[model samples]
Target: MKKVLILSTALTSVAMAASAEEISVMSWGGAYATSQIEAYHKPFTAQTGVSVINVDADNPAAPIKAQVEAGNVTIDVVDLEYADAVRMCDEGLLEPIDPAILPAGADGTPAADDFLPGAVAECFVATIVFSTLYAFDESKFPENPPTTIADFFDTAKYPGKRGMRKGAKVNLEMALMADGVPAGEVYALLETPEGVDRAFAKLDTIKNDMIWWEAGAQPPQLLADGEVVMTTGYNGRFFAAAVAEGKPFKQVFDGQVYEYDGYAIPKGAPNMERAKEFIVFASQTQQLADQAKWIAYGPARKSSGPLVGLYQDGKTEMGPFMPTAAANLTNALPSSYEFWVDRDAELNERFNAWLAQ
Candidate 1:
């Protein structure tokens, strides 16, 4: 009888292990992924007994499209930029996510009303509002640090290597801004052919001095390694290096372009229902607010704001560091998703041609 009981227990153990479910999530790595792992993945796993696997990419959107088009979808949930999310949804590459699945805010507000404008879309639910901004190593410019977007392009003044993302999106807008275009008028100017030429013209000035980086984590590393004096990067990575790791990096918010980053399930995700459940859990007010504790990005849900307090360090407040903070928005530009969605391919093609030249 004891032998029989042991056999039954072993079989049960194997069955339970086999039944355990796991979902793969693809996101931009570095401090950003750490934030999600702590605030969303850990708690979600604890609550549901489902394992969460993280996959890192320079950008999640391309791999998602590739996997879906090839009809061998491996990633269950993917973090996406606002423009990519909208573009993919339009192409029917993402599964439709009903806002009804999200829970009400901690303050008892409904999900639809609680989420900031454009946070909830047909196939995407935004989790945080992040920004792309340039930061310089203070040690690199001890006397007169760069204070404006124009300084980023003034290779003659700054006189050092600069790091920039290997993409056209934020670079074009910043080029226009550095060339003296107002934040509100950037997209309008880009709509004209002359304006496109002007933006590219500005970029040409610093082309030789620029060290192109494609990954979110590369900027901070480049600055630390002294590969570049200044680099445009996501704000949170810089925050982690400076405040958390005691790096001498300082961020310049002038000409910053802020936008939303969110989660979506690819069409035909193997674990579609479970992926939906994970998104619902991650987008809740508390989870969103908790994410702010680890990174500087603002929570997308309005109710999540009040819950955002000190950073993980326990003393540093997160409000002033957020891209949406009042002080930071003085010359900041909200990235126009519509403009990118419409012009992405055309501009990128031109950008690639320019790069070749």
Candidate 2:
């Protein structure tokens, strides 16, 4: 068995060498991956002749930690949330990415200066500013659409199964917001035991009516298949389905929780050099801006903002749909990476136990 496995690996390696160098990048699949593929992978492959093999995970951060600890790292680069990036870097699970390797913005500003605040961390280079927002099928509530976070929890009025991600982070915050706690006070309130109870109690309101999802791709499909009427999902996925695929979806940006998602190399990735090259290439001004065309995620670089224009359909403007847009910011909450980094494990454990009950 060992011999056969070794021979298979050897033959695969030989084949790869004869064809092209390939780096595996694990990301949340669906429209998000498609955006990266169009904006980064194809262009990078064309420029360097190093093919990119895309991989998907429910959460890329988990597999990265497992692979590094097991001494069998295979993924060259992973897309991760800011908190996971910071946590893994602190735990020595990821490679330290030097900012010097990144290119200057289109306007000639240094990479460090050009990227938005907290966009670059010790182990990651933030690529996009995305949001976790709930959207409903237009067909679900035709007369009166869900316009606010509170409306999402009003199952009595709306009358349908709700979709939520199978995790604690966004759900807790949303629960607080839906319960009428101001966005500014969410994390502060969450710091107290009473506040935690309040959030959980609010979540209990829709617990029975909830359909939990793991992958970013699931929510759109859940909505499409009529499995759910309204679901919290990455804003980009909703944009792709509604705009690109012409599905009957509508984004409810009110009380949206936005965060940075970026690329990090696991400590011992086989193609370290290629991974670095890919990161630098993908983090460039044009590439980041180009990504916005395919999805609603905002580029992390300030220079890229001006470059973002129409969507892939070439008619719809992308600016108003972004989480960073002025109109969208009215009821938005920027996720605190520091808060999540500190409490992720304890909260997740509590969340799992709550789910089991």
Candidate 3:
């Protein structure tokens, strides 16, 4: 009896140790990360008995690439934009996620059939559809309020510094649209050298008045502190500040560029199985719907749409604020993943040289 008791105690300890395993996740931090924490991370941990260590990256793609190429992969999973996800997959920096393992939708539709068009990719499973939109402090723009993308570059009219991401992707697209290129023609024109120059020339107009931001959290802070009269940032970040924190920020949906942000495992993540498990758990229909309650981003799953309604506050409707809403899409542009996947390196190089000059 004494010998049996000792063996039982040892087995239980081993099981407890195995159950306490941890996985590191990297993402764009701020209310976005908070929404994932409340909707996906906490519930996943509670259900699986696995510990999640969350980390922030200005852009998870950059650090994830570095970590993978260095052969020192610490992050098990990362949330990345559609283009970055596709680019990374092409570079073989990420592990391929199998659609077979993903759960079916709440209404019994297959995973492949249920996700929004282009949401699921070879290397990543998309979680949310978000937009890069500019926001302003209402107090700063009361008289002649800035409304359009052209106004974002009109420093003489708005008369204050503007906050833009420290990257060439969305800015270039917005520049073209602001400079009178139709949203439909923006990418087609950008395929040429002269068109690239035109976009940069538009950007040059506001270069002196620009304050560059990397993290999603910085724009709201910059707006609230009166450091910038207008700033381009994720729509959800502005929503959190305006609705949750009761800040006076207002999003400029005109010329907003919408895209998907999703999950991908590093090529040689330490906790591959557990990371895959987390993805499966978080990508379920109900889980995706739950995320919208915390942030205004539209869930990637179509089945999750009807289920989405109120914000976590329980009174504010989240539909009209979503980037995919018909009202918001009238003047909006859909970000082209293929364009960025092929041109990201070259354009960013030119962008860097332009910055230096």
Top lDDT: which candidate number? 1
Put down candidate 3 lDDT per residue, 1-357, tens digits, no spaces: 999999999999897667548889999888999999999999988997788889999889999999999999989999999999999999999999998999999999999899999899999999999999999889977887888988898888889999999879999999999998889999999999999999999999999998899888999999998999889999999999999999999898999999999999999998889999999999999999999999999999999999999999989999999999999998889999999999998999999898898
Candidate 3: pairs in clash? none
Summarize candidate 2's per-residue lDDT along 11-81 as a digit string, tens digits: 99899675438999999988999999999999999998899999999999988899999999999999999
Better candidate by lDDT, 1 or 3: 1
Q: After superposition, how far is residue 268 of candidate 2 from its true place, in Å?
A: 0.4
Q: What's model 2's TM-score?
A: 0.94
TM-score for each of the candidates: 0.95, 0.94, 0.94
lDDT of 1 by residue, 203-299 (tens): 9999989899999999999999999999999999999999999999999999999999999999999888889999999999999999999999999
Q: Which ten residues in a row have the lowest lDDT in candidate 3?
A: 15-24
Model 3 residue 240 distance off true place after TM-score fit, in angstroms: 0.5
Global lDDT for candidate 3?
A: 0.92
Off by over 4 Å in 1: 1-20
Cα distance off (Å), candidate 2, residue 15: 8.6
